[model samples]
Target: MTAPSPARVVAARVLERVVSEGAYADLALDGELDRRGLSARDVALATELVYGTLRWQRYLDWILAPHSRRRLDDLDLGPLVLLRMTAYQIAFLERVPAFAAVNDAVTLAGRARKPGVAGFVNAVLRSFSRRGATEREPRPPADLVEALALRCSFPTWLAARWMARYGASEAEALMRALNERPPLALRANTLRVTRDALAARLATEDDIATLPSRYAAEGLVANHGGSPSAWRAFADGAFAIQDEASMLVAQLLDVRPGDTVGDVCAAPGTKTTHLAQLLDNRGRILAFDPQPARLNLVREAAKRLGVTIVETLDGPAEALAPKFPALCDAVLVDAPCSSLGVLRRNPEVKWRRTLEDIVTNAERQHAIVTAAALMVKPGGRLVYATCSLEPEENEDVARRFLGAHPDFALDPPSEFPVALDADGFLRCRPHQHGTDGFTACRLVRCRR
Candidate 1:
């Protein structure tokens, strides 16, 4: 028999790491790809299999559970992962022939030293294929939470939360949208080139197709082709890869040249650099993060993008609040969150996170926002943002902060690409806006 595809083998290994070791899928995939030295096409294939399998894991499990004589959870990790990978290809990935998918999975099982498991895998996959599995849609469980969870490949608790907040129809739509692959969006660095100018240059030099983002003025959606980072425009600091919804946060902050801004959690510097670009690289930005290594990433990105105004401060955000009380013209509390909004890009999040994480994140967010509040000048602006769809993390925290700090009132952003709630907070949903789910509430500190 022909050897199993190297891409499938790599994908299975990555999934095993993600499932058994709790490793982040992207990092694990990157490490494996680098070590394996796969071709570009193979790399893309492996990436799709890894992400797609994870994205539809719940659905795959639902189908496999009924087929396996042994409990799926009780099976060895290697065999179980192989089964899921094969099921994904059989049920969803039409480009992969069913026979090849089944044969590859059986081959992988034997290679794992479980020759007995190979027969079991062949039987299960052949059963699926013989029954015309591609045409069969599993019936939804009677319970709404369970049904939506299985149907959309989300955790029951998460599905329940969305249903409670958005009603069943909208929640299903949101979950369906989240299962899709997000377009790669790049923000043009106006300091180096305009959006139109960069798009022109990319077409001429890289042959990468491009389209303007509906909301973010500088945002461009790469239509097709290789990674933009490999292109010369990226090397020249022409743009930063960022979601359109995230781009809105810096825009709402409205930093002007010479403004003193504070980024409370500015690691990896996506927004920090955007702030510099908006300021024309002439303002002072005190970027703070708890981790020194992550802060180093911000510094490197700033150097690459030709931004020189940001000063890195390596310490917890809360500690800095006391030292520079009211020192910033604007402060961004981009608090760590449960990350429910960016699920399309990070599918593992749906499986890894729990309902209790929402509460935990909210508690941490409350403290961070409270501390960051101290850095904004009395008459200056403060924006609290998160890539989360949860009300507790978004609106409730904003409300609680307003209640405690009477000096700060919701300012309600006037100009943004996404829709605003009645309270004037910026809210973008994956289904509605085709962007990562994000919420930002702008507040103006009352003058003493």
Candidate 2:
């Protein structure tokens, strides 16, 4: 028998990996795309299948439950994922033919080596597709928060959490924004090329267009889809693929050309390189993270971005206190987070996470930032930041850090470049700012 269509097979496999093996969707998809060598168009389809299925998983399950005899969770991982990915195509991807999606899924199901599963997949998909155009779809429950969560493919608790804080109208706007594909945001590597110059070159040289970001001078929004890492410019360190909001986090530091900076949790060094860009690659940036393997990623990023000043420290934040006491002019604690704010970019996160995870992460984040606080020189600043919309990880951690450390006071919001909330924390929301959700606050160490 001929093999199943490459894109569909890849998409199904990726969904299974994410669902069963707990693989990161982006990394797993990238590994498949790189190895399979599918056409650019097919690669796009496979990407859409994986992300769309993952993004709308809760809603897709709701749609599929009525048709299948077994509970979705009761089904084996392979067939269940196949149904979800196929249903996503039928429900969302207009360009894809529903019949073809069904056929491809049956083929993948057969390969799962499970008896009768292919028949089960075929029956369910065809039944759903035939009725989908006419069916009203399962009505969202009468409760507004649950209804919104069902429609938006979010967990009910998260929806309620947002509604309580942001009000119903705005909470929905944020949820809808998180469901759509996020724009490709890139930061111009000022160490190598100016933003305007890079934009001009990408357009003229590669036919890829970009728009300058309003909030970040070095930030550019790519008009093209897909990562530009393969482009010659990427190799030359002309840009770093990063969110506009992320680029602005480094701006909160207000670093000069020469300053000692500490970057806590600086894995993959996206911000460390940005800090170097701010420093004109002129001064020292001691980049710290717990994992040595991840720290190597930081070094590689710094090298590729032409950020020579960033020195990688291979250990946890706690180590920094004893080794570099009061050494940094300004220290940035880009603390680990629940990452709820980046749902649009990382849809798999929503499915894998629970509300309890947020509170648990908050505890760890507070500890790391407190350790990072020790490395800051008196009169210098300690900036705590996270890619999370949740208050526990963002606001609470920052407040607790200040309460515990008597020497530091909250920096005035006006000192930073971005628009901050009433409390002076930089809250960049996807709906409001057209950027990833980020909360960052600066605290100044009082001089003796």
Candidate 3:
């Protein structure tokens, strides 16, 4: 097999930034992919190496722990990163030769660290490469964290929380799915083109195929063919890269053409743009985010998709009620949470979030949804959603809001593909949805 290239080296550097400096993978990879001028294949390889390594880090540590003389945490972070990268390729990526993976890891380590560290990395990776090498047995279920640490490739506390919330089987399934590479999903800009038309354009590449979206008429499941951003249609902004579960949120809003809508916490405008597509660029959408930078992103996206109906506002979601009380036909509060569901895409979030963070975020979500509900006129719809699977931020917040606001009650709608309760709340998990770990619920304000 061919040896590792300069692109891999650049990927290692970016991965090191993610592991050490806590940089975002998407942002960091974008910079390096452009700086190194990597080909499409090389870009895909780098992304797989970096994201796969980060996703399965705990498992990598477990595999290497037997060979290390020092504590795994005490090992030099740079060389340890190389070990993790090598482990991911060896365990998961069958296309790459084992020797190449091990050698490249050692080479990358030598370039990044001292000779001693490189030697250590080489020895450990080669040691793991030997078949039938001794490893710690699969951890016992009695110790939930330890079991999950070994089984699911996640930090102990995170695994424990999931194990508690969703039993051992479901938690393991979710974690395994999250650790896998996410499929590319896109929402077609119906205002410009239909899903069938977009798929026909994408058909130029023999490897590309799309399925009808589970939720919306405009949604398409773009199978893994090549770099999605490099696709011609994407360049023209005919569609936007989004998760299947995320696309469902906009569909849940059930918005119509020429209706007034408000997207609270709408930065980078993933759902906001989808709402515009649903409205056919005829309705008013008041998009709000506290950060100017993200609002700029929303504006940029809107421009690319040819959406002119959205109006951007700079303020917290809670503050929007005062300016737009009883004005919107629908309100979408995509509140922030621990982001455990999308940890596969952003692995750093696993280590960054704590249980307290969940509670605090739930508090903020409740506030946002409560106030966001005020913006919806009586008998209008409001959708409260989050990427987080944690009930604290989903059902708990929704329940709290309903209890406080007697004017609002659960609304039943039968349009969803998944099973929703009588209250019309849809909760999807990676285990169930074949998508990210997300939970969304739709509510309606009762007529006064």
Candidate 4:
């Protein structure tokens, strides 16, 4: 028997981790690829298969449901994942021939320890191949939410919520935008190199192209011949991978030189380092997070970017308000969120997050933002931001905070470089702005 293709095997293992163990897709795929030592082309193919299968799993399950005698969820994990990977290639990846996909799936199934599973896999894939193996358009459902969910491959509840918030046409656009592959956006480390200088350096190098970002002054969208991380510029800390929308958040904070800034929930430190750059490395930034390991990431980022003003603090972020009341000239609360806005990068999030999770996240965001508000001095600025399209975590939370705190007023939209809603909030959507969906509100505290 022919052995399973390396890409298919790697994809299946990564999918198993994502689906069965709830492991993050990016992390799982990276670990597997490192261990397997596949060629770059094979690694790319494996990545496409894993992300595409997960991104379209709901739709694939709908197609598989009619063919399988048993429910897709009830099938053994190995076979189910293999089926999804094969179906995704047949439907979406034009480079992969239908016969090859089926053959590889059967080969993989035969290797599985279960009896009769290989026969079942062959039968099912052959049945689809007989029908021309073309992706059939989903029939419209009676309910708008169901129709959107099925067509766009999102959870029904999330589709329903978007429909309610954005109306039908707009909601559909948002769903389509989220389904696209996100651009590789990089932020030029100003302390080390200017944006244009970095772009010029990359252009001079072999097989890399870059375009200036529309909104962010220090941002570039990279089109690479290979991994951007492997570039000499990256090793020299000329740029850090960050979405243009996230770079905008640091700019919105307006941290000036010699100011004292607080970054609550500052894990991974993309924005924290940006804040230091905005300060020209002159201001002191207290970057706080509950997880020490994540805090260490902030420290590492700061060091790599040549940012020296950031001080990492390990503790619950909320606890900092009492320890440093009215102590900062500016505070950034990039709260934990469902991250619906970043679905293009992390497709598994759509399947894992529930509507109830939104409410729970909103409660936590409100608490953290409240704590952050206390750290900002009178007449200082406080920016609340999230990578979520959900109003419960964005506008609703901001409104509730305003109702409770009379001293804090929404800052003018002019404070931010990006376009803003009439209510003075900066809301960037992927469909409209071509950036990750982000919402940020800048508030100023009045003298008590």
User: TM-score per candidate, in order?
Assistant: 0.97, 0.97, 0.94, 0.96
Q: Could you tell me which 10 consecutive residues in candidate 4 have the lowest summed lDDT?
A: 130-139
lDDT of 3: 0.82
Q: Which regions of candidate 2 are displaced past 4 Å?
A: 1-3, 132-136, 413-417
Q: Mark the regions of model 4 whose C-alpha exceeds 4 Å error after superposition.
A: 133-140
lDDT tens readout by residue for model 2, 208-315: 889988789898988754558777789888998999899888998888889999998899899988999899888899998989999999989987877788888788
- Tell me the deviation in Å of residue 297 in model 4: 0.8
State which candidate has the highest lDDT.
1
- Minimum summed lDDT over a 10-residue window in model 3 is located at 131-140
Q: Write the per-residue lDDT of candidate 4 for residues 101-156, one digit (tens) a residue.
A: 99999999988868999999888878766655444543567887887798789899
Looking at model 3, residue 101 earns an lDDT score of 77
| Cα lDDT tens digits for candidate 1, 250-357 | 999988999999999999899999999999999799999999999999999999999999999999888987788999999998989988899888899888898789
**Whole-model lDDT per candidate:** 0.90, 0.87, 0.82, 0.88
The better-scoring model by lDDT among 2 and 4 is 4
Residue 163 in candidate 4, Cα distance off native in Å: 1.0
* CA RMSD (A), model 4: 1.6
Candidate 1 ranges with C-alpha deviation above 4 Å = 133-135
**lDDT score, residue 258, model 3?**
91
